[model samples]
Target: MDCETGFCKNDVQCGGAGGRPPASLAEFTLGGYGDQDYYDVSLVDGYNRQVTIEPIEGTFRSTGGKYDCKKAGECHSNLLLSCPEPLRHLNSQGHTVGCNSACTKFNTDQYCCRGDYKTPETCKSSTWPVNYPKYFKDNCPTSYSYAYDDEKSTFFCRGSNGRISPDYRVTFC
Candidate 1:
């Protein structure tokens, strides 16, 4: 018996006594998503054949502020979605990851309201997840201040003396 994409061949006697269909070709057919570039598949048969497909690149146009972690360490956009669990840990391991201070308005009525200052420090300490290091706790323990310096193209935690600390020089992106 032999099988191809759309058909199969089986050898059987035509007369005397009817021969059974080849067991190999009994349950085989063109079964998969016809339009998808790749199929979600499982082979129940004993044969160990290998297959590979080239990736298809799509050109969907998007309209929004681009996520430029390279320059800002973090970006604020509604377009961002929750990171997957495993990657969330990795992204937030050293410092607060995917933190968006610009979009979240901190006011007296807000749930995160603790004081007058509307800073990432307040938001991060109170609202950000506890597993990862907060901005002040990990990167700027002594300074407790951070800024996205466009000139330097980096997010820097500043010390109390208004100087970028050696500890805060590490890249969060």
Candidate 2:
């Protein structure tokens, strides 16, 4: 559990994804982003599984702030249920794998926030497909539903030693 550099490019397990439940509940990397251990409840690429990063001792705990990842009102809007007809991604057993971003699903420059639309202003969320982003946002408000969600999406973590992390947990619901 010692990663001295940032998320290794080839490490598929860094996010605790791709594994079955419980075993994948705690996603950790000894190496971290920059000098700080940064993590996110990221859904920018799309998701079907519902996961949450409940901070044990961080700003998410200290401030009691909800930030972008707020509790939603409805089951469908809040939990990402019954994914849109076109956006569904099913595995061989017919269970949903993950949601695909507009960019992944459609390959459009605007949806991707690529090409001339790389900036936040240029890639306004208001212009993208409605329910898809809404589903992701409502389900995991703190995560990045789109490209420009970086500033608010990432959460910084550190242990008592004060040098980022050696252990972290990302829980799945």
lDDT of 2 by residue, 51-163 (tens): 66544544322223443223221123423346665666556777555556666578788888889898988888787755467666665566667778766565554444543
**lDDT per prediction?**
0.22, 0.52
Name every residue pair that clashes in candidate 1: none
Please, what are the lDDT tens digits per residue for candidate 1 over residues 1-173?
53321112254333533222111111111212421111111111111121111111121111222311111222232111332232221122353132222112121322233454345445443443432223212332221111211122212121223322212112211
Among the numbered candidates, top lDDT falls to 2
Residue 10 CA displacement from its true place in model 2, Å = 14
For residue 100, what is the lDDT in candidate 1? 24
Of candidate 2, the 10-residue stretch with the lowest lDDT total is 19-28
* Candidate 2 clash figure, as a count: 6
Instruction: Give the top-scoring candidate (TM-score).
Output: 2
Angstrom error at residue 156, model 2: 1.3
